[model samples]
Target: MHRTASIGLAAACLAAAGVAQTASATAPETPATYLERIAAIDDAGPAIHAVVAIAPDPAGGAQGGAQGGAQGGGPLAGRAVLVKDNIETRDMPTTAGSLALKDNATGRDAPLVARLRAAGAVILGKTNLSEWANFRGDRSSSGWSAVGGQTRNPHALDRSPCGSSSGSGAAVAAGMAWAAIGTETDGSITCPASVAGVVGFKPTVGLVSRTYIVPISASQDTAGPMTTSVADAAMLLTAMAGTDPADPATAEAGRHAVDFAAALSGASLRGVRVGVLRGQAGTTPALTAVFDKALADMKAAGAEIVDVAFKPEARMGEAEYAVLLHEFRKGIDAYLAGLPGQPPARDLAGLIAFNKAHADAELRWYGQEIFEQALAATDEAVYRKARQDARRLAGTEGIDALLARHEVDVLVAPTTSPAWPIDPLLGDHFLDIGAGSLAAIAGYPHLTVPMGAAEGLPVGLSFIAGRWDDAKVLRVGAAYETVRSARLAPPSLRRWGE
Candidate 1:
């Protein structure tokens, strides 16, 4: 069967099943009704576990109310947005995909949520995420957690939706929301987006505030957009940027916030310099072909393409892992201390004990060895050294040095290989030659846009720009997406039984 035909057949079968399940399925719901319908569908069919909680009344006063001029009339007015559970919202509990903070609710919104409200977006609900943003355990399933169950990939019902922002990626791809917010410590955002066939943008560390958000590593964590298009991602970023009193890092963000939409001139790619990282090769032939087409597209669009050889940073993953473990222990403790009521699990030791008490609920698939490792560490000096080493190798000696040598505006590579078949028993068997390692460890910005499909699965082309040059990455991604004309469509399956 032709790939498009296969997609159509899958969608038709699913839609038929959906129609049979619901009596009122004659037409797609309006924005208000659509939100409710999708939320119901998510819970019943596909069983995607994409949503952590749905607002009983998403169109209530907190979400701008019914009289709020069609949800504020902003650029994304009338659009439904799914927020990753880790990003705090006063209306719902921010669990960070862990049972530890499942019942804790703060009556204040994260600064970014408030910004989204100001821009007129209808705050749909919270999406599931990897427990503690996947920092809790070694061998953790990327999209499984005690609080929200497991988020399934929309493309393949059984595949992992690589996290820690799994829900955001799946929700957007499944049409549960027009767009969603996803945070990254490393490959969390891009990984899921790549696998789910959506756009994921990891902004420079300070571009979005981390205050009121559940933190893993304050130095590396920043909230960005997970959307179906580069244009939608850019729109969300505009609303998310600005200095906030709660987060000091964002104090420098004002200078970086520009009208990214205006930068989307169809002719912007003309005279642009793009560096293709030749060393990185995807896992499959289909993915490589998709990437080759993307490179050709960029060249045909008048961008200068330079193929550059770059080696994988030695020991970078170990060093970055060390930093995350150390930070997770310290950051969670501090956040718990500031909470108003008794926290579900007060500290790292308390959390470990709680998980032991409820193994079925917490440790069904993975052990908390990562948390144990973080807890076992006693030396602060070693932790600081590991962080510094990671920065040196990934930043000064890796991405920055390579870019300087090539004199390129941005580096491009396959965001990930083709989507792996979904497996519940063994968890994610990802085979992608990832482009995130450099940007992640170096604390640089990375953006991925859907280039085309590999087999029936989608492939993303990554744009890795200079530090604090998120705008440049967004500009180029937007331009390429416009020319490529790839649109994200939801999966054909409506439920597991189907």
Candidate 2:
């Protein structure tokens, strides 16, 4: 079938299956113009706090204005994007959703930000995130932060938006921005995107530069795109990727970077081998039903699917947690030291003290058990061993071994279960899910595409590809997205105070 026909056929199937489509009537405009629209929407009454700050220049009036007329003809000339607060932009402050660094602004843009600006994408603003990317406390709510407050899910006002990259996901879903940049150390991007009903791509470590992003762990830290469509994610990623002299890890990215949007042909998934990770199943019956339907769609699209069962050792999660705690302290210290102007928290010790001093504001709901644990573990030797073991087991023995044995291009699983009930008093009811650990431990690329709705909430099907295979992952995701046709329209209450 022709590519366009395939999309039409897929759309028809989805509509028949009860997926309603809402047409957006707005015509294409420059990125600068888009920002102006955002300001008009957000600044009015019932304003949602999705955006932390807007850039000084509104679209259309500025030199590199939002309409893509910037620098003559840049790749993302007319695209407007919201960047998560954790990713530093010289145009905005890098608060990381915390009051500790409320005034902190890096003098220069992050490498990824520089790439976006070079491609002519306008920085609409910074989106709210879980304070310190949700690494601060064991009982922290996914989307709540001391600085930005709670970001409501666009799908349901009463529901949670999920963590770390919550505002980025919500903004994209609500059409506040065409796309947004989100940083993930583990489940941050996937969880938020899954709950908000958007597409999120967590590229392999080093696939995108992490030079100015707030750190949890250098090994697992990476920035990715959260967009309404898989194709949009690919377009945003193509502009954000490439080697960065500021981050040594990006040296490995090399030619792994490619025009991901160009790889979104209809037949991209044809003859591709996909392995279903059976070990991660049995969360919710609704999710399973969606998964089955998705599998059927892929089969109709001429892709091979195999059910593979290879659960990792139980100790892997514990070991991974240990590594993150140790690395968070060290990585955060390094990041703080390099910040321009006065440092907010000079080291982990100072950060701990700052949190304690501002407990009423920062620790209103959750206690800093995770931070305390990191503070308690001062043994370097034990930390090094745990970190090494986690990487070896998760990367070499876990994900890599299973993919090689199955000979699959990607491993598929539920990005997350359904959106749990949002309870500020009790925090997130995430339970024990199979996300974060695999990708976080293995340090591989993981992408989440909207699969279907479960009880009026969104669910995402995950794609875990091998290290540095970002382009291939994007291609496969875009192809499946075309077949699934599952992107959702924002709820009626998307505008703040609605």
Candidate 3:
């Protein structure tokens, strides 16, 4: 009865938002025009290098169908979406931003890609990402990749575009695509999206399928949307959410197919209690100032804010790393071994060897210590125990406890610190201030919307909710976004400090 009432109330809110769940038509632009615009920004102006490869139209031509097909096929019909390299597309190489799988053209789209196609979306192309999704080396940079080079921030050419979904976030921010698909293992999706001045959403773990995606932690990995607006993210997510027979994680996915964006309209924060997260922000004046303004806006919108203390398992990080190491080998090996075409390396050991052989290119900057550790791991008991312990800390003891104790529907925090300068020699020296781990390790849905900028770079405010409460979470964020619609365009990278 409680769940039913909540659903009904949410439906009423959506009807009041003005637009229907379906997207309205806009003046159609040529796919070529989009590509030209993207190339001008990414390849020519400041060399953003966001897009790794532009996929050919399914019709075997450069120009994709831009017209909304007869009857307006689907909400995303005729939309051009950029997918991260790690997510498979039948036509393009799924490199995961690595030199090893440069020829990994599987000719088999992942389940999510099929859903996008069924919804009439044009698969624009693959975007660059951190090599092996930033799990290869401890010293590796966020946007640096041997396959597609470095992806520079659109806000500042020298700024870091946080990864491993670096190119997905950067490309969407630069108008390369209407939206993009990005997979997250921990902070991969939200971090890049927040720092890039875009909207990023990580759905509940089982809300989407993970088949054919390059994996890090099976316990945490899920692909979500990176877009300029919460509406766009919601639309993309709606198309991508469904159950996959191949992935057991999504057995309950169909039960979560609510219209995420509809709840965004006329949404109010009034009478809603939000727990202010306790971690990694409020230390720096710039970040704190921006966050304080966001809080003020929420309060002005009538939200009751309360401070809460959350002590995540002291050893959660250690356990998460251990689980990932063991699971990466299990997951990556299965994915590689099953590919139709022969990839450069079929296993972790071979991939490591290929890196050594191509040292001038792949290994020029950093060693694959993480890969080595994963390859050497043999303790199944340790992996299972770590997964259990981390899930408990991140779930029941972390996000759940806070909400229950504080009596808040959602939690808020500074998504991350402002973008840091991109340093090639030392790699990413980030502020490590995001509250992503709580939702990430818990397999809960997390949303990051633009808060404001700090030092010419953007920061975001995050909304964290209980598992499978994605619609409510989106509504909460939409309510905040209603008051603070600060989603801005990307920066002209050539002129940074002038």
Candidate 4:
């Protein structure tokens, strides 16, 4: 079958490129050193299956040319960052973990990638993600991709890493890269980072450019940093936050952009009014214990913890899903049409047909129900109403109301429940108790920092603020980090409940 052949060809390509090389025991000193680390852990040692392709040497490759004369000697010098495969890189194929895009090597850098390169980050490689960023099927497993296989959680090899930013989260937790980029529409970044035990920051949507990255909902899709600490997240955000001529949403980014890294030095929780959303925290007793401890730590650090109430409108969920389906069809059509060369599928319809023709690979575990819904989403008036209603419920009448009514600077809650068992038959068991949805739907800033573990599985404490309040959100998270318990270290690969 074509699916099987695509997998074989991908494996052969990696083998030919010698993706894994000899690794050193000490810290990585160069880009090649990081590649060695990825090889040792991601390919041979525990085989986490995080990386999809090891970027070829940039000398003479399109990477060098695509940088547009921006030299690498900025703040990120000597650092190496892994990119989510959904984001295009000039030197590697930008497959969204789908065989249909296995040959999508567009010789151009997404403005975000170019920014990182200009800031001196070595483009390490592309990390695997949920196939089609977990948009193709309703019952699709998180982290399972036909091109790179399933990306496992480093904490417990058997648990889900949470997608579609699965590999970006796991690789950072397992120490496979200095840091990684993750794109999110809803829970993609925060969910993975929380369960994987790392920091994930989804900035105000317009703060980062969405151009050249595969889209789901342009209104909600934004690339963010998934790192080991709040400081690193700030460092990456400083370089990444800017305007791009192509992404009109970012027209106001220049006015809001600031030196995020420098703001951390003055961060403090003293006298800060923090509104708590208890309803969003998970119901498990163990998880509650962890969250309670986090609240205590914040209160001790001089934060005013005020419990708040929030209830989503009855139709908000339906409207949000409708908005995503409408946007995915429109955005993906534009993205696929703009790709260079004879790419596999030209639009959503073509992608659906391609998946049908290769169902053994693409649909072995799940059917393309979401894809069908998206393709059939043809009502412009309904989509407009849905977008307006969803944004109002999640934004003006949702997060904005909570902050205004409570007289709080920001909001807090548990990021999500700990990692669930990875079951392909049942797909992702993502619980509804979390604080990411409102921020995501509102296109506001949301951040997750590791609070502690529940039953040996890590969980995160979330910090969220109104749109363009990114610096304030980061400062609060950093201040809490200083007073919180010791950060969770990367876990060794092991069996469940070990």
* lDDT for each candidate structure: 0.76, 0.76, 0.80, 0.84
Q: Write out the backbone clash pairs for model 1.
A: 46-494, 46-495, 158-422, 159-422
Badly placed stretches (over 4 Å) of model 1 are 1-30, 61-73, 485-490, 494-498
Query: Of the pair 1 and 4, which is ahead by lDDT?
Result: 4
TM-score of every model?
Answer: 0.90, 0.89, 0.92, 0.92
Residue 240 in model 1: lDDT:
89
What is the per-residue lDDT of model 2 for residues 90-194, given as tens digits with 9 covering 90 to 100? 877888888888888777798898888878777878888888999988778787878788877766766788888998987777666778899888899999999
Those runs of model 2 whose alpha carbons end farther than 4 Å from true positions after fitting are 1-48, 60-71, 434-436, 485-489, 492-498
Order of all candidates by lDDT, from best down to worst? 4, 3, 1, 2
Backbone clashes in model 3, listed as residue pairs: none
Which scores better on TM-score, 2 or 3?
Answer: 3
Q: Give model 1's TM-score versus the native structure.
A: 0.90
What residue runs in model 3 are displaced by over 4 Å at the alpha carbon?
1-29, 58-68, 485-490
Clash statistics: count for each candidate: 4, 10, 0, 0
Give per-residue lDDT, candidate 1, residue 265: 52
> In candidate 3, what are the lDDT values of residues 1-498, reduced to their tens digit?
000012232332222122111122123334555576555556555678888888765323322333444355566767788899999888888888887888888888999988887777888888899999999987788888888898988777788899999999888776667778999998899999888888899999988889889888888999999877777787788889989999999999888877776756677899999898756474888788888888888998899989877655569988889988999998888888888867878889889998999999988888899999999887999988998899888888888888898899999998888878887778888665767898998899999988878867888889999989998888888778778844344454543574
Clashes of 1: 4
Name the best candidate (by lDDT). Answer: 4
Q: Ten consecutive residues with minimal summed lDDT in candidate 2?
A: 1-10
